[model samples]
Structure formats: C-alpha cells, structure tokens
Target: MTKTRRAARTAHTSARTHRVLLAAQLGNSVGDGAFYVTSALYFSRVVGLSAAQIGAGLAVAWGIGSIAGVPLGHLADRRGPRRSAVLLALATSVAVASFLLIRSFVPFLLAAAVYATAQSGLAAARQALLAGLVEPGARVGTLARLQATLNAGLAVGAALGGLALSSGTRTAYFAVFALDALGFLVCALLLRGLPALPGTPAVPGEGPRLVVLRDRPYAVLTLLNALLLLRLPLLSLVLPLWIVGRTAAPGWTASALFVLNTGAVMLFQVRAARSVTGLPEATRVVGRSGLLMLASCAVFALTAAGLGPWPTVAFLVLGAVLQVVAEMWHSAGSWQIGLALAPADRIGQYQGFYGTGVPVARTLGPLLVTTLLIGWGVAGWLVLGGIFLAAGLATGPAVRWAERARSRAAAPVAGEPVKAY
Candidate 1:
C-alpha cells in the first residue's frame, strides 16, 4: 500500500477507537447516574435497609472495588487495556443484573462486590487505552470531552431514573442493568478493531513486578486525593438526606442535583478545559483548588440559619459551584500528573494508584458524615465542609512531595530529555 493510504487507514482506525471509547463511557455513566438516583431510595424504602447500613455497605463496596485497581491494572498491562476493559464492562453488566434480580442484603452486597472489581479493572485499562490512542497534547482535550459527555449522560440517566421512580415501579432499575450490559458488549466490539497502546514493545515481562509502588509521586498524590475527596460523602449521603429531612420541599432534593449538574456541564466545563493546559506543576494548582473547596464548604455551612427554601438552594448552589470547579481541577490535574509524572513503563499502575484517592474517600466520607449527622445537626454538615477544606490543605505537602519525586525520576539520562513516549 502507498504511504498516504497507510496514513489514512491509521487515522480511520484511531477515530473508530475514540468513538467506541466514548460510547462505553456514555453507557457506563448513564447506567451509573440512573442507579445512583434510584438505588439508595430503593434500598432504604423498598429493600428495608437502614441509612447506616446502606452507607456502610456502599463504602465497603466502593473501597474494596478501588483496592482491586492496582493488581488488575498489572493484568491489563500484560494482555491489553482494550481486552481488559471489555471484560470488566461485561462483568459490571452482569453484576448490575444480579443485584436487581435479588433484593436480599447478602445478594446486594455480592453484586456490589462484583461490580466494584469489574469497574476497578475497567478504570485502569480505559485510562491506559485512551493514552495509547491519542497524542500527548490531544489527550487532555480528549479526556475533557469524554468527561463532558459522561456528565451529559449522567443528566439524561438521572432524569430517566427519576421519572421511573416517580412512576413507582422497579422498571428503571432493571432497565439500567440492561443498558449497562449493552455498553460492555458495544465497547468490546469497538475495541477489537483498534491498535494497541503507543510506546509499548510487543514483548512481555518488561515492567516491574510491583511497578505501581515505585511510582512515589503518584503514590503521594493519591494520599492527598483521598483526603480531598472526603467532600463526596456530603453530596452522596449527607446532603441528600438533609435536603429531604430538614426541609418541606418534597421533590426539591432531586431538583437541586439536576440544577447542579446542568450548571456544571454547560458553564464550567469549557473554562476548566482551557485553563488547565501547560500547567506548571500539578501539586500547586491542586493545593489551591483544595483551598477553594474549603471556602465553599464554609459558604455551605451558612445555610443552617435560614429555614427558607431559597436559602437552602443558595447554599447548595454555592457548594455546587465549588464542586464543579474542584471536579474540573481534580480531573485534569490527576490525569496529567499520572500520565506525565509516572515512568513511561508503568503508566497503568500509576493510574491505578492514583485512582485510589476517591475510593478511600468513599470509605470515609459517608461514615464520617453519617455519624456526625446523628450528633451535630447542620453543624455536622458544616464540619464536613471543614473536613474537605482541611483535607485539601493538608494534601499540599503530599502534592509537592509527588512533584519532586516525578522530577527526580524524570532527570536527564545521558544528557537528553526523558523519553516520555
């Protein structure tokens, strides 16, 4: 074949891979949004579970799932990110189906475990696969677009699930299972046609056995991220319950989330994408964003005084504002740091380690907020704000530590710049 023809084929293939990836993400996130909107309510009201039980179970499930990312990441590296992602997607679909089929606690817990493991493996593979498909500069934009799309999917899914809940049937839950399954099958088919990751030799057994642990910068950053992510529990558990129990606005809770998501995707995402490019150091920006998140929590705490609906809305809105900003900052900064800071030979492992930050938060946030909710009232929620802010600030040192480690690791060898490719 002529050179021009070969280049055209490569371009076409790359586009196909990107399309498949986006589809997989869309499906997964849609199902995720739908499930989250309805699942807790179902678990509490229908499944007859307590708030503490539900909270503890989810934290355990997510944390366990997150812990699976590193080792599974090694397996993905051994075979291929595409294939691993495919298997994980399929497993996730199965897990969701299983959970819906049986409403018992043991069964539900089992399903959560299965989904957790599948998602962890999928997370590592997908990140590595995306990096392989795109060039360095383009990767950032690709990730941003992917996030924006998922958020859009999230909105659609949440709306559909909310509507389904309003209908007072379990149909939406089952539908989510089916949708998740289809996403996996679609991703598997699309991935089969793409090229393997760039910069990797076809040879096997070339990387370190525990290569992820060697990535000191990513490891340190992971700790900071764990601390910062403590904010999620407030949104996931505390605020939802608070909105429902504290105020008389019956449907106001969902409406607030709906508004929050809308504002995030439409107004903030573009600005986040543009501003994060060519950043000096991930540590500095991450630290500052953490500080702002703290400020936002303080703003949210003020909502306690006003019994009026608009006050709650205003407080929640302010919190959402900081959250969107923080989400953008965290997403861009973490990916860049993981891909750029880690050794080229061990990107997948680094990604896994980096991904753990959120899981750790998942474990702690709900438990912390739930306990405090019983004891402290709105003050407890405000304390959560303090936690998020403090977590962010405390992470500054860890971030700087990671940056230094990455710099040392990237030091010139034989007087030439490091071969990141």
Candidate 2:
C-alpha cells in the first residue's frame, strides 16, 4: 500500500477504536447513574433493609472492593487487560442482577461486596486498555471525551430512573436492576470486539512482583488525590443536607445545583482538559482547581447568614458552578498525571493503585463532611476550604517529587549517567 493509503487506514482505525471505547463508557455510565439514583429506595422498600444497614453494608463493600483493585490490576497485567476487563464486566453484571434476590442483610452485603469488587476490577482493566489504545499525547483528551459522554449518559439514565422512582413499584425496581445488568453485558460485548492488548510481561528474576506499596511518592500522591475526590460526597451527600438545614434557599435549589453541575461537566469537561497535555500543565491545573474549590467553599458559607431566599439561592448556585469548574479541572489533571506517571509495563497495577483514591474518598468523605462541615456550620466550611487549598497546592510538588523518584528508580546502577524523560 502507498504511504498515504496506510496513513488513512491508521486514522480510520484510531477513530473506530475511539468510538467503541466511548460506547462502552457510555453504556456503563448510564447504567451506573440509573442504579445509583434508585439504589437506596430499592433497598429500603423492596429489599426491606434499614437505612443504617444499607449504609454500613455499602461502606464495608466499597472498602473491601477498594482493596481488591491491586490484585485484580495485577491479574490484568498478567492475563491481559482486554480479557480481564471483559470477564470483570460480566461478573459485575451478575452481581448487580443478584441484588434482585436479596431478602436480608447478609445477601445484600454479599451482593454489594461482589458488585463493588467487580466494578473496581473492571475500572482498572479498562483504564489500562485505554492507555494502550490511545497515544500518550491524546490520552487526556480521550479521557475528557469519555467523561463528557458519561455525564450525558448519566443525565439520560437519571431521567429513566426518575420515572421508575415515580412508579414506586417492586417491578419497577427490578426492571431498573435488569436494565443496569443489560448495560454492563452490552458494554462487555462491545469491549470483546476490540483488539486484545496484553499487559507488560514480567522480567526474569524480578522477584515476581512490582510492589506499588513500597512507592512512597506514589502513595502520597494517591492520598492527595483521595482528598480532592472528597468533592464526590461533598456534592452528592453534604451539599443537599446543608442546603436544607442551613441555607435559606428553597428546597428546589439542591436539584438545580445538581442540574447545573452536570450540565457544566457535559458542556465544558473536554475543553477544560484540552490544555493538560503534560505533567507541568496537569499540575498547574490541579492547583487552579483547588483555588476554585476554595472560593466555592467561601461562597457556600455566605448562604448560612440571613441572606434571604433568592440571594441565598444565587450564592448556592454560584458555589455549585465553581465546584463544577473545580471538578472539571481536577478530573483532567488527575487523569493525565495518573496515566503519564505510571510505568508502561505496569499500567494496570499502577492505575489500580491510583484508583484506590476514589473508594477511599467515597468511604470517608460523607462522614468528614457531615461531622466537620455540617456539624460545625460556617466555620466548618472554611476549614474544608482550607483543606482543599492545602491539598491542591501540594499536588504540584507531590508530582514533581514522584517524577524525581521515578527517575532515580529508572537509573542504571553502573557508570551510565541518569537520564530524564
């Protein structure tokens, strides 16, 4: 074939791969959004579980699931990400489907644990696959596009879930779970068509392991990332309670904030990510994200005074907007840093280690936000803002430290001088 024809073929193939990956993300995200919106209701009404039981079960499940990521990620490295991802997706579907059979606490807990573990494994494998498929320069942009697609899909799924919620029937709940399972199954099928990309082969006499645990810099980075991810529970859990309890804003303000946040992400997430092509830029973005979040917290604190209804609502909305902006930048920065910093051969293991931040935040964020922020009132908001500032500002130096450590680790022990990438 001529050079021009070969180039065209390669471009076409790249586009096709992007499409398939995006489709898989969209399918799973929609399913997740739907399930998340209705899960509490389903467990409470249909499964006859107390609110405390559900919360405790989910917390334990996520904690266990988070721990499972490392080993599962190692498995992806050994067996190949494509196979691991597909199998994990299948397992996730089965676990979700099992929710329908939950008659008591034990069954529910078991099902949740299985589902969380499978979901975490699927995430690590898929991220590893994505790293292999997309060129290094385009990985962040591709991730941004996927994030946008996910937000759009979630918006649609949330609407469907709202319909089921309105119906408030056991059959409706069952149907939602069935639909969620189907979505995962469909995603797995789509993934199956992609070319298989295996993980890095283990080197001879390399001690049979690449110990992520020993990487202090990486561990510190993960901890910082987890702090940033506290935004998740901040939005979903704390903000709602704060709005109703402290702010003079109308109750509808919470829903409006959700809409605003989701809409902003769908519209601008990709744009926000476009500038984050390298480590320096990514670090700057993270730093900026923290400032924005800090400003948002200050704005949120304003609502606690006698601001009246409309004024309080306006401040609330403004805070929400800032939070979303911060979210967009934080996500872009995190994706780029996580992917770029990982060793090529051990992408799955590293990505899994990096991803532990999400579960850590999810498990701890609600408690922290509620007890520290909500319980303390406005002062708590200021303190939380201070935390964001500290974490965000620390991220750049942390990344630099990590890069230096990586260089030292990669250096030859003999007379060869150290070389930096």
> Which number leads on lDDT?
2
What is the TM-score of candidate 2?
Answer: 0.96
Q: Provide TM-scores for the models.
A: 0.82, 0.96
- Minimum summed lDDT over a 10-residue window in model 2 is located at 412-421
Among all windows of 10 consecutive residues in model 1, the one with the lowest summed lDDT is 412-421
Candidate 2 local lDDT, 146-191, one digit each (tens) = 9999999898888889989999999988988998999999999999
lDDT per prediction?
A: 0.68, 0.89
Candidate 2 yields a Cα-based lDDT of 0.89
| Alpha-carbon deviation at 371 in model 2, angstroms | 0.8
Q: Tally clashes: model 2.
A: 0
Q: How does residue 371 of candidate 1 score in lDDT?
A: 79
